[model samples]
Target: MLPHERSLVKRLQSQPFALIGINSDGDADKVKKILKDQDITWRQSIEGSTRGPWPTKWNVKSWPTIYVLDAQGVIRYKNVREKAMDEAIDTLLAEMKGAKK
Candidate 1:
């Protein structure tokens, strides 16, 4: 995911796109090391230790949950990856482009 996400970030740098990560690892030191080792540069926030973690609030029960949203912030795709994820993003971008013209 690190490398693929990095490629995605680079590929879509000029587009209205962003990749946000919510890390749930309990070891802050390890997390920091992993980020540095993996060269993760996109926006990332450690999952809070509140009563309701982001996973609970967002109803996520697994790691690597992916959601693809459009400009309107609607969840147009869920759990998409690789070529499917790319297609979903491209379709949304094309739709946005067509709507403006």
Candidate 2:
């Protein structure tokens, strides 16, 4: 999934797309190392603890939950699978482009 997402990020580099990651890993140093090793260029925020306020605030029930937002910051899709993510991104990008024209 990381490989696919990394590729998507690269492909969408020219577009008005951004990937934000919220990591629940407890160890900050380990998370930093993993991010660097994994070549994750996107901005990420690390939760102090998995059972902390961040999870409760976001209502994250699963490990890899995803929320896709549009240009206006409204969540267009939630908890979509990887394949669906690609389609959603494409659709949103098209909408964005259309709005600009």
Candidate 3:
């Protein structure tokens, strides 16, 4: 699996989070199928054209980008390249727990 894919799986298993991946080229269906086969529930949105969430909203420049958003739909982690995601999950959980306190 891709680093981002692995990171997503880890998050889904451990947190109250949702994974949404965008494919600007309109090929997200294949990725979705693969994830489904692995029993990974992910949501995907495809842009109408090459004009992705850029300059006006999210400013994404690459394909297979991952955005980890909080409950209020605000982006907390926007790493273009995927990482291990352990620290990120800890930080997000801490923030959520702090808010609840």
lDDT of each: 0.82, 0.86, 0.61
TM-score of each: 0.86, 0.90, 0.58
Model 1: residues with Cα > 4 Å off, grouped in runs: 27-30, 48-52
Specify the poorest-scoring 10-residue window by lDDT in model 3: 47-56
In the range 1-97, model 3's lDDT, one tens digit per residue, is 3555655666567677655555454456765665567665566565544575642266666554566667677777766344535567567868888
Error of 1 at 39 (Å): 0.8
Error of 1 at 87 (Å): 0.7
lDDT of 3 at 36: 67
By lDDT, the best candidate is 2
Q: What stretches of model 3 exceed 4 Å from their correct place?
A: 1-7, 27-40, 52-57, 80-84
User: Clashing pairs in model 1?
Assistant: none
- Lowest summed lDDT window (length 10), candidate 2: 45-54
